[model samples]
Target: MAEHAEAEHEEEAEPRPKRAPIDWRRGREQAFSILASIVRWVGLIFAALLVLHVIFVIGSANSANGIVSFVRGWADGLSLGFKDLFTPSDAKLRVLVNYGIAAIFWLIVSGILARIIRRIGGVVSS
Candidate 1:
C-alpha cells in the first residue's frame, strides 16, 4: 500500500505539457481568407444576377413583375457599362452577349483581386 501511495505521489509530481501560444499571424491570414471568399461570393452573385436577367429577357418575362424588374435593375447596375458594348440585330442576342461579357469580366476581376489580397496577406504575415 505504501509503495502504491509513493507511486501515485510521483505520478502527481510530473509536469503537464505546455500549450502553444496563440498566433496573431494565423488570425490575420484567416481574416484575409474570409475576405477573399466574400469577394468571390460577391462576384458570383453579380454574374448570377446578369445571367438571370438574360434568362428573363430571352424568355420574355414580364418586366412589370417585381422580381423580374428587381433583377433587371440590379443587372443593369452591375453591367459595368457593358450593356451597349455589343450591337446585334436581335435585341435578345445583344443582351446575351453584352451581359455575358460583363459576367465573365466580374468573375475574372474578382478572382484576380482575391489572389492579390491573399498574396498581400501572406506578405504582411511573413
Candidate 2:
C-alpha cells in the first residue's frame, strides 16, 4: 500500500541522532567517583581492618608503637635514611601496607552507604 511506502520513506529520511559532547566535568566526576569507590571499597566491607589494628597493636606490643611512632622519626630521618628512595624494604613493606590499608578501608565503607540507604528507604516507605 502507499502508506507502507510512506512509512518506509519517513524512516529512511529521519537522520540519526548525534551523540552529545561529553561534559569535561564528567571526566572530573569520574575521577572523584573513582576516589570515592576506592574509599568505600576499603572502609565498609573489608571489616578486617579492626582486626588488623588490634593485631598490629598486640603483635607489635613491644615494638607496639614502634611503627606509628617511627612515622614521625621517619619524616625527620627521610633524607638521611635512604629517603624512601625505592629501597626494597620501603617499596615492599611501606607501599604494601599503605595500599592494603586503603583497600580495606574502602571495602568496609561500602556498608555505611548501604546502612544509610536502608535507613532512608525505611523513612520514605513509612
Candidate 3:
C-alpha cells in the first residue's frame, strides 16, 4: 500500500512544458514593417494629390466642380512653400514645376521618415 501511494503521487507530479524563447529580432522586424507601411501609405496619398493637382492645372479642371475644387484646395495646402519654387512663364511648365517638384519632394521626405521610424523601432524593440 505505501509503494502504491508513492507511485500515484509521482504520476500526479507531471513536468511542465518549457516556454518558447521570445524572438525579439522578429518583433523588431514586425515593428519596422508596420511603420514602413504607414509611411508608404502617406507617401502614396501625397503623390496622388500632387498628380491630381497637375491634372487640374493641365486639363483646366473647372473650379465650379466640387471634386476639382477640393483637390485644388488640398494641393494648395500641401504645396505651401513648394507652390512657387519656379515661376515659369509658360502655364504647362509652371504646373510641372510646382506640383511635380512637390510630389518628388514628398516622396523623398516620406522615405527618409520611414527609415528613421524603422531605426527607432529596432532600437526600442532591442
Which is the leading candidate under lDDT? 1
| Candidate 1, backbone clash total | 0
Ranking by lDDT: 1, 3, 2
- Give one digit per residue, the lDDT tens place, for model 2 in 68-102: 55543333232232334343553335543443444
Question: How many clashes would you count in candidate 2?
Answer: 20
Better of 1 and 3 by lDDT: 1
Query: How do the predictions measure up, each by TM-score?
Result: 0.83, 0.31, 0.75
User: Model 2, stretches more than 4 Å misplaced?
Assistant: 1-89
The numbered model that scores best in TM-score is 1
RMSD of each: 4.7, 13.6, 3.7
lDDT over C-alpha atoms for residue 53 of model 2: 38
Between candidates 1 and 2, which one is better according to lDDT?
1
Kindly list the per-residue Cα lDDT of model 3 for residues 11-88, writing each as its tens digit: 889887899999988888897879887997898798789889898878887879999988888888888688888998
**Using alpha carbons, what is the TM-score of model 3?**
0.75
**Candidates' lDDT values, in order?**
0.95, 0.50, 0.86
